[model samples]
Target: MPGLLYLFTLCNLVIGTGAFVLGGVLAPMASALGVSVAAAGQAMTAYALSTAVLAPLVLVLTGRWPRARVLVVSMAVFALGNLICAMADSLPVLLAGRVLMGVGAVFTAVAAGIAVALVEPQRRGRALSLVFIGISMSYVIGLPLGAWLGFRHGWHVPVAVVAGTAALTCGALAMALPRTISAPGASFQGLGDLLRRAEVLWTLSLTLLYFVAIFCVFAYIGPVLQALLPMSTERMSVTLMLFGLSGVVGTVVGGWANDRFGPRRTLTVQLAVLAAMMLLVPLTRGNHALIVLVFVVWGIAGFGMMSPQQSRLAALAPAQAPILLSLNTSMLYIGTALGAAIGGPAALTVGFDRLAWVGVPFALAGWLTLRLGVTKGASWRPA
Candidate 1:
């Protein structure tokens, strides 16, 4: 199970780097493409919107296919999309490529479903979080590397590298992922039916708000880090690495907390910490050492929320777990899209140094929605 889970982790690592490398490479991408920094950020918005809108359609169309087949094909599509992005000479071409990459979001959703399905119910939380560790690890490895390469050589270098790895991951997933395992896939009507439920709707709202809260800053983190976290060039390198390492630690601890304390309790604490950090991060400007501590804790709380949120939604509708997870992924991306879309312009008005303020309302709304609107148990309101 651990080995198989790590395979899924590697799969996510590639997919995640492809998705997140934009942040590190944003400046050069903007310079090369002849767009504003905010405009360049829309490439992320394009990718997120594509994932938010289309991955579900892919899920519905390929619902009955083998999970292994879906995983393989999705990585292939992801590789193709990034290759297009690397070759793009203009913004329209870039947008089209990102839209294609949107097809890749299914990989993560399906991976999560498989992770939970393969494990004992008691251990699903840990298994699920472990699957996402690759994404956190990307911040440690992929983002920094992508940024450095983009800065020195060209933005296309890192994007082309992402394409190569994704192609390799396709072969690895094809060989490693079991063809015999066929978990339930989501249908269009099945997804619509789940959305009609009040509790499910509210739970998905929680997901949307949670991500909007984080990505407001995260979407522009490279710039925001430069503005807000006052540190020397050497310390800045260490700070970003620490942020990634803490994410791995947070992911591990989040799973344990979910199993030990339940998703609701764990999320309450995580959300509160996340909200506090967003506000606190801006205030720690002059004190570099203190800022690093806050940023480390922030990464822990930020990445830690994923497992618990997925657990809550799964527990909400065990029978519809795949579809629900798919929907949650959509909301997550939608939130990410909203954050990027909002952050790009808002950063101008608020200043990157003070940008965490944008996420505060979202954090508060997510907590309120979770506590007040979502049901404690899996009781769905009648159709």
Candidate 2:
């Protein structure tokens, strides 16, 4: 079980790192491929869009397959996508590679969540959190490593590394995970019925809004740090590490809170904290010490939202756990794309200092949505 969890997490780390490390390499990629930074940005957007569109579809189509087989296949596809990315020299080919990668990532994410849930009902929160740690580690280690590699060896090196990681993850999953099928009646109609529930809609809405708010500020974090701190490359890397470390801590805290307090209340508190931290970000510019403090708080508040939100979604849609979780993941990537699209223009017009201010209302909106759902008799019990 531990081995399965580690492999699953590693899959997430590679996919996430591969998808996001492009942000750091945008200038170099644009120069090499003879495209504008805007075009390279669009390629990233394409990746998210592909993930969002494919996640539910893949989950529904593969609903009957042995979970372990599904996971192995997904990782294999992910490896191939990265291989494509590593070899591609043209803009169109790169975009194609990203699309393939996104599809593989979407499937792996959904399948992993379902596999974790199957491990132990009581330990669901911990299991899911452990898988998501891959994502947090990607933020903490993979992205920084990718950036460093991109700076030293060019953009292709990181993509190649991600491909290698994906291959290793595939092997691990094949060897470790047991073959398991979904319970009877876990079909597409079950997923449709879950989607029709108001509580499920509310939970997903909260997921979407929270991600929008967090990613809005996060999408421009590098640029914001550059503009505000004006740090040497070494110091900037250190700052990134600090932010990632904080995320790991936050994930553990959120998992603990979810298990102790239940998902709804924990998520509500985390979202509120996130809103408060966003509001504080504008005040911390140019003060390196204060900036680090704010980032740690932001990491705690932002990454903290994930476990509770996911646990809530799974509990709410018990009959269609895999599909619902897959949809939630899709919403998350969509939220990332939306936030990036909105924030880029906002940053261009209002500057990075004001980006946090722009995200505050979105966080407040998420809190309100979750709060309203709770008031309307959405039970906290696991589905």
* Tens-digit lDDT string for candidate 2 (211-321): 888777676666667666677656766787788888888888888788888887788778878888888887888889888898888888788777887788767756567
Best by TM-score: 1
Q: What shift in Å separates residue 351 of candidate 2 from its native position after superposition?
A: 1.7
RMSD of each: 2.5, 2.4
Clashing pairs in 1: none
lDDT of 2 at 245: 84
User: How many residue pairs of model 1 clash at the backbone?
Assistant: 0
Candidate 1 lDDT tens digits, 165-188: 999989988888777774677666
Question: What C-alpha lDDT does candidate 2 achieve relative to the native structure?
Answer: 0.76
Cα displacement (Å) at residue 347, model 2: 1.6
Question: How does candidate 1 score on lDDT?
Answer: 0.84
